[model samples]
Target: MNNKAFEVLQKEAPEVSEVWQQFLLKASALDEKTQNLVYLSVLSAFHLENRIPFHVKMAKMHGATRDEVISAVLVGLPALGNIVTTALSVAIEAFDKD
Candidate 1:
């Protein structure tokens, strides 16, 4: 449970965050809101709840509505409905937090 290591690394190399943003920016076909919604769906499908909040905020910032957020979270209904539902709750909490 040594979170400090990651904190230090990110502090020292904040450019990693920027690099990821830049990479994400390369997908020209999708606008920012759509991209964020896709990211939310992917994260939920992968059970990566930790990132749901960040993506939710970004989605809202990029014009995703609450209903759209819910829909995005439920993208893979047949295969991952349960997990995505949990992620939906997290997404809403995070959206409110933002």
Candidate 2:
């Protein structure tokens, strides 16, 4: 039988699973919209993860403007530097959607 995504994650790494749950709880402590914007910023960090589109959509749903999301991504550029930050261009492409 195919396990659900959550189940697979739990089995794969129980420690990570706990941290994930805790992260979600903290994110959810904010308003739904703010939470979504935060998630979008995170996904923007992992361009190849294929999670960018979903989180960008969620960010929009949460009332974040394109500028806000882009700014958030840009905020990481200093710390992540060019090499890592450039990878997040995929998020800009994703955000270009209608």
Candidate 3:
């Protein structure tokens, strides 16, 4: 349900989780926003609805615009089908938060 999964994973496997975090933070060729967008696409494709808003907010913090996230969600179109149309609303609302 949210980042609770990631939190639990880190706590349960701190060493491995730290390594994976370092890999994403340092080993990735993509920028932060790009990585977040990629994560969004993958999560949406997998129908991981619970994680959507969390990643959407992270992407926005990493400099992804609303339009950019819209495009990312659409990239999962073949697998997501009509869900993309509605998921966009959640993503947009994440960015709209006060």
Best by TM-score: 1
Which is better, 2 or 3, measured by TM-score?
Answer: 3
Per-model TM-score, in order, reads: 0.79, 0.59, 0.75
Tell me the spans in candidate 1 whose CA falls farther than 4 Å from its real position: 1-10
What value does the lDDT take at residue 76 in candidate 2? Answer: 58
Q: Which stretches of candidate 3 lie over 4 Å from their true place?
A: 10-16, 78-80
The CA lDDT of each predicted structure is: 0.81, 0.66, 0.81
After TM-score superposition, the amount by which residue 79's alpha carbon in candidate 2 deviates from its true location, in angstroms, is 1.3
Window of ten residues with lowest summed lDDT in model 2: 40-49
In candidate 3, where is summed lDDT lowest over 10 consecutive residues?
Answer: 83-92
lDDT of 1 by residue, 10-61 (tens): 6887898568657868846899999999988898898888878877988999
Residues 18-84, model 2: lDDT tens digits: 9986887675768766776666656555543366666677677778788877776666566666644
Per-residue accuracy of model 3 over 1-98 as CA lDDT, tens digit each: 35787889888999989998888789889888999999888876766767888888888988899889988988878865886666677777777883
Q: Which order, best to worst by TM-score?
A: 1, 3, 2
